[model samples]
Target: MTLELTPILTRLQNMLQGFLTAIPNILIGLIVFLLFVFISNLVRNAVHAIAERAGQPRGIALVFGRIASWAVLTLGLLVSLTIIIPTLTAASLFGALGVSGVAIGFAFKDIFQNLLAGLLILITRPFRIGDQIVSGNHEGTVEDIQVRATMLRTYDNRLVVIPNSELYTNRVVVNTALDKRRLSVNIGIGYGDDIAHAKEVILRELAQIDTVLKDPAPQVLVKELGDFSVNLDVRFWIDPPIRREANEAQDRVLETLKKALPAEGIDLPFPTQQVLFHDQTEETDGHRTRQREGWPSRGIERDPRPLREIRPNSEEVDNRS
Candidate 1:
């Protein structure tokens, strides 16, 4: 019994000595990790400021900044781990990371896809905040751009959150991307009216309106020989491509054309039809006759009664005759 206890005490003493020897190294590793964390935060802030000054989006800049800081901190952690475990090498660490990356990719495939798409959008900037865009059936002004989603304010005052991946994959129409947009209004003139004269009157009216752009010049083209009248397309350009502005300009231009065309003897005609009355009675030949029944006209009306009085005995003459 005395020999067994002596062997156990000797082994315990050796283990205790090894533990004490490792304590300082563990302490140093912990201190190094803490220092790395502090430096990482500083790096994050610095990157954020630089990107912002260079005109990058706020949300995207922050993302890049955070990535930089985390990368630095991760390197520091690897260094500290090496200090604690002297056998650990950079190659081993990277090999472990590669294996873990596969697992992470499989686990969060959709999340990573959106993350990558969001980064691409921030860099390319196909549409920016405050831009009015239409994607799929959704249309609105962009409010915020985030890593996973984007926020929009619809015309009816509703908020919409769309996934970044969907937006990136789909077609987007940016309405206000240009400073000016062209709009067309169709008006019909009587077939009898002079085409060249009507176009002249339209150009005159367009020139009077200050909202219409003069650089592109207004155009009036004969679009169609419509059923009732000739259709003319009046196309004009306006500045500040906004929906409301375009509508208002259309209304103003229409009103101006309405008042000016007729005053200038340009007839804006409506549909008219010719009524032919068919006398189907067997007593008379199958012939169509014209009759004016509803209203009096400026000119004299034609007597509908036939020559020699179709009915000779309908009116009795005086017997003395």
Candidate 2:
């Protein structure tokens, strides 16, 4: 029995020897991986430097550089893996991954969409860092754009991170894109007041303000004739740098108008209803009496009696003729 076990041990030793001969392949795979990592790092640094020199924001540059570097490193890793294990060639790996890839993609669909949208935003550049923008219900200054989301600093100094997908699909209004913006305000005055004088006063107030542009000129139009007051639309052009000053300018303008109007004897009217009463007994024969003196009465009277009566037919004498 001892002699028979020796042959089986010899065969096991032969198999082990053959497997040990492939150890060099493992070392080569590790060397290739390290080389790829080094190359990827070098490329990433170079790209980051170029982007920085181009004046791109640090966050945006890092986003682009990291993405590019990782993409290259992933390809290198695949190659190394295939070399180590001959069964994992590109075609075979892709074919197998194709089935499971759909599942993984479905799980992270939103993330992928946001990533793509962010990339589109970086490329197209509809707005940039420090731009005041309003999208969906969010209004703020853009602080940075990442691979999956955009960061905004609100007026109240709160940080809001919004998904890039939503930002791309909705309407985006860039307030700072134009060199100038229009400021409009609706003001009301008493109906009987002089509109020309009111407009002149408004124009004068607007002219005194330093933020208001004089080239385009300020506009004053009578927008509507209200029941008790006249609506005046005041529109003025403002430079981009003066956006922060617009609110202050508006407040000052209103305050000035409020104080100036009364000095000029102009009245800012409020809503009011007037009612008139009449006495029916004071009416003459067929004429209705006026409700109030100098009220300028008009229209038909509300009388209930008939003006004349109709007579019955009497043709009996005509029938005999």
Candidate 3:
């Protein structure tokens, strides 16, 4: 009985020693994981605070903070795994990543392209935040630039999310970048009216508008000879910083011109036509005359010649003076 007890006790002691040795490793791994999690959360909170202080949107800040925290935690987990299992190494991880790199690239080709374009836009700064811009067919003020798309607030108050790749390739028109912009109005005048008088009236109206810049002065030029009138091009410089005010000023100027010009007998051009009907009959002198059946004639004697007596002549008349 003593010999059997000794063997059983020896086996139990070996099992207890093995458990004691493994417990320390398990505890160390757990501690490391907890420390990494704590640090990640701290960094995330700090990042969010910084973004908030910098006037960044809370949503964007939270998204970036989460991404950063995930990246840090992933690195920490990889480190912990390596420590726990000595067989797993950075070289093996990189080799596997390289083997699958092509598949990953193909899967995220569009996403990578948009990310690169966004980076380029941020670096080059062709247009900045809150800039009124027209890119491709969309016209709006830029709100933000993210990894995938750029946000724009249209003039109508609609939010537009455009992909960055399209912006990189298409032309972008920045309307508010310059301090001054030009406004053009097409005006028409009657064919017989005095163009100079029309221009003077237009200039006077534009002078009353405060939003128009006086230094550059307003320009009036004859643009085209239209079907029934003369077209004039009225161009004036305006302060870009007050674009809405400038537009209102332009409208006022046009309205004033419309009213004042008409009052001053300066007629604005409109389409008109003058038509005449002719008779296919010729007099004895082979001269064509308008047909008037019952109208009194002037500067000619009323001859009682019969209508059938009228004859055609081919001889040409020499009336050179």
Q: lDDT of each structure?
A: 0.84, 0.79, 0.76
List RMSD in Å for every model shown.
10.6, 10.0, 10.9
Every model's TM-score = 0.62, 0.68, 0.65
lDDT tens readout by residue for model 1, 175-229: 8888889999999999999999999999999999988999899999999999899
Off by over 4 Å in 3: 1-91, 241-243, 274-321
Clash pairs detected, candidate 3? none
Candidate 1 Cα RMSD (Å): 10.6
**Which residue pairs overlap in candidate 2's backbone?**
none
What is the full ranking by lDDT, best candidate first? 1, 2, 3
Question: What lDDT is reached at residue 136 by model 1?
Answer: 84
Model 3 poorest 10 in a row by lDDT: 312-321
Expressed as tens digits, the lDDT of each residue in 212-237 for candidate 3 is: 88979999999999988899999988
- Model 2 has an lDDT value of 0.79
What would the per-residue lDDT of candidate 2 be over residues 124-157, giving only the tens digit for each residue?
A: 7888888889887778888988889999888888
